[model samples]
Target: MTIGIEYLRVVRERFAVLKGQGDKTFAQLDEEHFHWTMNDESNSIAILIQHISGNMVSRWTDFLTADGEKPDRNRDGEFKMKRMSKAELLDCWEHGWRVFLNALESLNEHDLVKTVHIRGQAHSVIDAIERQMAHYAAHIGQIMFIGKQIKGEEWANLSIPKGGSDAYLQRMLKEK
Candidate 1:
């Protein structure tokens, strides 16, 4: 694969890591937790998921050939609360990932440097992907943090537990 594609792959892998963390975090959370906005200013997980889905659909639909920000996208409304079941939330997540991966799969080496407009700002295809990767990762962190806070003691650590890095490193070294 080309360097640009490889980087996109890395971004996707990081997304997988976040998705796994989200799954664990939301496992015990119900529809109540998914839709619960902490306060008037705070956003719920459901809203975030919807925002991401909209983003993926707009940005990745025509992807290389069109603007990343589609005319039909309602960016402001993405923050609005939407009622959803756990199954529905998962479906939204899956749909976004499918669209994102499909766009990634269709990319060619030459498309990396191609310019795409996001909200009318120009960015190279690779840069655009990188920018959104960071954007999504930030939200994933928020989702995981919120999940941990809500689940408290019941929440299992997604990564190694406190002070377990030595053992984890040792195991990785042994495998290598």
Candidate 2:
């Protein structure tokens, strides 16, 4: 594979990491906890998921031919409180990832340098992907944090169990 393809492949794997974290987080909560916020001004886990999915759809749909910000996207409305069941929330999340990850898979080295616009500002395809990746990761972090706060002692470790990093590293080294 060419260098660009290798980078794109790594990008694809990063999205998978997000999916895994999100799935595990979702599994730890019920619909009742999805909408809890620390304050009136703060966003809840549901809002974060909605915003991330909204961003993914806006940036990925028809990504190459048009501006990354779709005219129909209600970016601000993503933060509004909605009575979303866990199923509805998951549907939105999966839809966005499906579009975004599919776009990543379809890219070639030649596409990496091609210009794309986000809200009219131009970015190379690579830059655009990097931007979205960071945005998504930030939201996922919020989701996990909130999950931890709400679930408290019941929250499952998304990575190494609090003190298991040494064991994890040793196991990895042994496997390698």
Candidate 3:
């Protein structure tokens, strides 16, 4: 594969891994846990979902042609506490990822060198993708942290569990 194609493929895989981690974290939490906050100032998983979804839609829709911070996006509103069912929250999450993934899928190797604007600032497509990847990964980390805090001892491991690294390594070797 060309470097650009390889890069796109790897970027999609990385994003899938991050999304999978978020999915595992969500699966471990109850509906009420989505709203749990460490303090009045901190955002809950619900807020994070709203913000991430809003961001994804804004940044990915018309990704190559328009500014990433869309004129219609209410970025601040995404942070406001809103009571939503687990299903609703998941729906929002799915929508965002769908838009993002679809946009990525639509890109060709030639698009990688093209310029895109985010908040009126110029960026190459590669830079734009990397920027959003970091953003989503950070939010997913927050979601996982909150889930782990709420579940405590009951939380299932998303990766190699504690004291299982050796076993995990052996298993990986066997697969190879």
Candidate 4:
């Protein structure tokens, strides 16, 4: 496959994997669990989700023509504590990802080299995408960590469960 197509495929797969990981974690959490945090200064899962959605919208809307950091973005507001229903939170999350993934999926090889501004700084489109991917992955890890913290013994294994490495490795080898 050509370089652009390969990159696109890889990016799409990575995004899907991240989403699946988040989905599994989220399913194991309730509204109370989502709002729990380690301390007053810490971000609850709800806050994190809000922040991610806000960041995604700012960074992905008008991704090529306009600045990634939109003038109207209220980044600080994303972290404020709120009593959002699970459905509302999920809807916002889906909207953000739709905006982001749609922008990403529409790009071609030529678009990869085009200048995209993020807060007035110019970046190649691929670089901007990579930046957002890294940002999202970090937050997803936080979400998983918080989920695991809350569920403790009840937490669903999002990856290879602890002490199951030998079985996991063997299973992978068999698949290969």
lDDT of 4 by residue, 15-48 (tens): 9899888889989988788889899999988998
How would you order the candidates by TM-score, starting with the best?
Answer: 3, 4, 2, 1
Q: In candidate 1, which residue ranges exceed 4 Å CA deviation?
A: none
- Candidate 1 global CA lDDT score: 0.82
Could you give candidate 3's per-residue lDDT for residues 1-176 as a string of tens digits? 89999999999999999999999999998999999999999999999999999999999999999999999999999999999999999999999999999999999999999999999999999999999999999999999989999999999989889999999999999999
Q: By TM-score, who's the top model here?
A: 3
Could you tell which candidate, 1 or 4, scores higher by lDDT?
4
Clashes of each: 0, 0, 0, 0
lDDT of each: 0.82, 0.91, 0.96, 0.91
What does the lDDT come to for candidate 4?
0.91
**Which candidate model has the greater lDDT, 3 or 4?**
3
lDDT of 4 at 24: 90
The sequence of per-residue lDDT tens digits that candidate 2 reaches over residues 72-91 is 99999999999999999999
lDDT by residue for model 1 over 13-34, one digit each (tens)? 8767766776777787867888
Q: How well does candidate 1 match the true structure in TM-score terms?
A: 0.90
The order by descending lDDT is 3, 2, 4, 1
Cα deviation of 20, candidate 1, in Å: 2.9
The number of the candidate with the highest lDDT is 3
Q: Model 4: how far is 170 from its true place, Å?
A: 1.0
Provide the lowest-lDDT 10-residue window in model 1. Answer: 1-10
**TM-score of structure candidate 2:** 0.97
Range of the 10 consecutive residues with the lowest summed lDDT in candidate 3:
153-162
Candidate 4 displacement at residue 103 in angstroms: 0.8
Clashing pairs for predicted structure model 1, backbone only:
none
